[model samples]
Target: MTAPRTPILAGNWKMNHGPSQAARFFADFLPLVQPADDRSVVFFPPAVSFAAAREAVQGRPDVRLGVQNVHWEEGGAFTGELSVAMAADAGAELVLVGHSERRHVFGETVDETVRKVGAVLRGGLVPVLCVGETIEERRADRAEAVVVEQLRPVLASISAEQLPTLVIAYEPVWAIGTGVTATPADAAAMHAAVRRTLAEVYGAQAAEGVPVLYGGSVKPDNAAELMSQPGVDGVLVGGASLDPAGFAAIVAAAG
Candidate 1:
């Protein structure tokens, strides 16, 4: 039997907090959340605050720090782009690749996402690759197809050895930041599809080890119900994660 995937409650503080704010958040929130062996609490602070965030989580093995985005190239003349090595130097243990904003708003292509994923692994960091369908695609009954297409190239780029370290978040465009969450049933169905796709690309054993997380409009009030669904191993929180009390509650709900 496949072991149960560890529940990961990752907060994506996208363009929200700076170093001081990040430090304050960790100081206030860390004490509120007791350490857990079966769960992980990750903070994806803005690149600028990565160092502070990392420092805040120091000595706490349960809490990990990650960067929102990283450039695929190791070193180059790319202006204002952060390299994976730079993120690692800042104490980031994980990186977010192909986030919805990076894909839909910033126009990150699938190939770029694949390269970024590889770069993160090469830099010795795990990757939380985001994949999801837009409202239009869901309305047209292409949710599964869209997710499959978005994930295929990136998953293909990762070798079987790297599969165990990867995390996938499914955040429907409409639900993200809109206070609209997919029903627990809907989320479970999509998560199942995601796992099936992983199994198809790799194998059942490898796919079972991967944690599939839901990200759209996740909050403390609904976190427990969502997490209880089949195939949903965790959550990638957005606006709700900005508040220490709110995020801590969500993490508690995950238990």
Candidate 2:
């Protein structure tokens, strides 16, 4: 039998929280979350705050640090972009690839996601590849197709052995940061589709080992129900994650 997927409650602290604030947040947040073997917590702080967040989570194996974004190139005049090696050097063990904001707001392409995924793997870091459709795409009944299109190239590019280290977060663009959420059922359906795609690329055993998460306005009040749905492994929290107590509650929900 395949082993149960460990739930991961990741906080994408997008553009929020500086070094001082990150330190303070962890000081209050760490003690509130109890360490467990069944679940893990990851913080995707802005690159500037990586050091503080890393120090804060020091000695706590249950907690991990990740970069919000990284450039595929190792070094260049790419000015203001982070490389996977730099992220790893800064203590980030995971990297967020193709987040909704990165795709819609910043115009990240599927091809870019493919390269970034390769860079992260080469740098020996895990990649949390985010895939989903825009509001219009979803309204047009193309959500699954869009997500699969965004994911296929990257999925096909990686080796089966590397597939298990990959984590996929299906964050519907319509629901992100808009006070809207994909119902537990909606999230489950999309996650199932994502798993199906993973199984297609890598065999059932490899696909089942990948932890697929849901992200979009996930908060403490609704986290438990969302997590209860089949195929929903955990959540990628947004605004709610900025708070110490609130994020702790969501972590508890995952547990």
Candidate 3:
């Protein structure tokens, strides 16, 4: 039988949290999540804070660090973009590709994500690929189609062996940072669809090994119910993650 998927509780700090703030966050955050191992806790800090984050969690290897974004090329003059090697050198074990803000706000294209995913893998970091639909698409009842379309190219290109190392997060645009969240049922539906797509590319057995997370406004108050949903592996917390107490509570709820 296949091993059960270990829940991944990732905090995407986005454009928030500087070096000092990141150090302070781990001071209060680490105590609550560590000394146990039922789930994985990851921090996607901005590049500038990687040193502080890495040092803060020095003794805790269980706490994974990821870069918020990366450039597909190993090095060059991309202006403000980060390279996967640079992220890895900073203690990043994962990379976030195609987050909503990266796509909507920064114009991250599907082609970029496809190349980034390949680069992340080649650089020995797991890719937490984000795929979701916007308010307009969901309102038009095309949410699943939009998400599938966004993810298909990358999924089709990756080898079956690389599939299990990847994670998927569905953060609907309407629900992100607007104090809105997809209902547990709605989240589960989309997660199931993601798995179906994965299965199509790599067979049902291989797909089952991929962890699909529900993001958006995932607060502690609703975390348990969201985690209870079938196929809902864990969460990609946003604003709530910046708060030590609240984010700790959400991590506990995931357990």
Alpha-carbon lDDT of model 1: 0.93
Per-residue lDDT of model 1, residues 22-74, tens digit only: 99998999899998898999989888888888888888999988889999999
In model 2, what lDDT does residue 228 have?
98
Residue 127 Cα positional deviation in candidate 1, in Å, after optimal superposition: 0.9
Positional deviation of residue 72's Cα in model 3 after best superposition, in angstroms? 0.2
Q: Which stretches of model 3 miss by more than 4 angstroms?
A: none
What TM-scores do the predictions have? 0.98, 0.98, 0.98
lDDT of each: 0.93, 0.93, 0.92
Clashing pairs in 3: none
Candidate 1 regions with alpha-carbon error over 4 angstroms: none
